[model samples]
Target: MAENNDLASGDDILASYHLPSPKPLWLNAVYARHIVRGNFMALSARPPTVDMGEWVAHQVVEHWRMLVTFIRLVHDKDETGHTICNGRTCPKMSAGPNHSFTWLNSRLEPVEIPAYEYLSLVQRYISTKIDDAAVFPNDPTGVSFAPYPGASSSPSSPPNSGGGSGPDWVGRRSGFPQNFLDVCQKIFRQMFRVYAHLYWSHFEDPLYHLGLEKSVNSCFSHFILTATTLDLLGPADLEPMQALVDLWAANGTFPQDSRAYGYANLRAGERLLALAGATTAV
Candidate 1:
């Protein structure tokens, strides 16, 4: 778990980012329970002998690999003639008319790009982060993941030891770096964007046509469950697909009390309409 910066008590941190119980998923319940939920429990338990973070890193890496394949399947999907997703058809990286994403260039400035380009960048970004030995250290070889660029110079941030924590462990040191949470959060956020883009833009064509609606629902629902339960994502991050989350909560795919559900301060009605138009089957 990431430590609190303000020297806040453990209870304070818990209250700030609570871990809600996992609700049984309507789609792929068995997989979600056995794979996602089981891993989370193991992490939370923090067994004395096991390197829990390393185990979690492996699971997260595998999940991203699967998610990348799933999204690529949609991108490469064929309908009648042309491909489902392309630069000309999807001009912007957008979940809806309301939510548009911009990419950071080499200079670290946000730049508008085409959807395909944006997703490609996202894939590259995740790959770079995971492969960075500083962030995902190799235990046997002992190279660590990167810390924040100027983490040591900053007074508020904690210092990071450059030691490797094996494959999944963020660090081999006594405490986990706050930067690990930051990196994982960013990764999950980008992944969420892909799911949002697929549901909003390509649901009817490739998703429905290819009969992948349930698969997407199953995967995304499990994704949401895992991400939220572990606090990798927050209410603001989930704003793009708020309506579908609400629908899931109503139907019990997510717990009613889960922080991942029912936090739509943004245009709730518009999102509901978007969800309704996307699919009523869920």
Candidate 2:
């Protein structure tokens, strides 16, 4: 229901930007700040004691884990009209027909997984009992070792051994079903578009007829500048942020305009500015 409610407004923004909506769960955070926080954490350098590269890699790994969980949930709901794997079900059970495996296998050519044992192994991996080292052990089973688009092929399928060379990174097989990639891409594109719109509306738009707009826009400009300086976004992503700043500058919608909205915008802007400054200082 919340998804449907968001869909109408989200659609309008997407239309303006020539994009589509991503899957609901992907973007429906209680607040935009949550998404921002996740992005920040994903990109930041890990603690001094930890392997920064591996730590960053974990972010992507975690995302995949969540996606798999979501696919399983949808499948169970479709098959039995009840929630699956919500802590009560048998952990070793196979993911049903609605699983992402169906979509992925259809789009990409089928790759060998160790028969019915694949799901059980995956479940164990998810439980964290095996540890990343054990799960990624040299010559790990049931994994497809493919080079990333820009990576060299010499690594020869993720080193098979785990802790010695780091976690073996498995990629989706080249021949995976087309529909699955389409869905994934569609979801990502929608996420980028909707967040861009929300960012503009809340931080770039003017609020009142007075100098309130100008003040709000000024705060937003400072926030953007600080964010850029901190490297929170790369040059490629900075363009939209700049555009938002320019829009606000031209519109003059500051706190003096609509006190409530302008004030809220200012508060968020201040927080973002602080985050940017802190990041840059580090």
The lDDT for every candidate, in the order shown, is: 0.57, 0.29
Candidate 1 residues lying further than 4 Å off, grouped into runs, are: 1-52, 77-82, 140-178, 262-282
Report the number of the highest-TM-score candidate.
Answer: 1
Largest lDDT belongs to which candidate?
Answer: 1
Give stretches of model 2 more than 4 Å off: 1-16, 19-39, 42-44, 65-69, 78-135, 138-282
In candidate 1 the C-alpha lDDT for residue 202 amounts to: 77
Encode model 1's per-residue lDDT on 171-232: one tens digit a residue: 33433454776677788889999988887777666666776666677678767766775566
TM-score of each: 0.64, 0.25
Can you write out model 2's per-residue Cα lDDT over 146-216, one digit (the tens) per residue? 22233332212222323364334322232223132233333322222223332332222212222243333
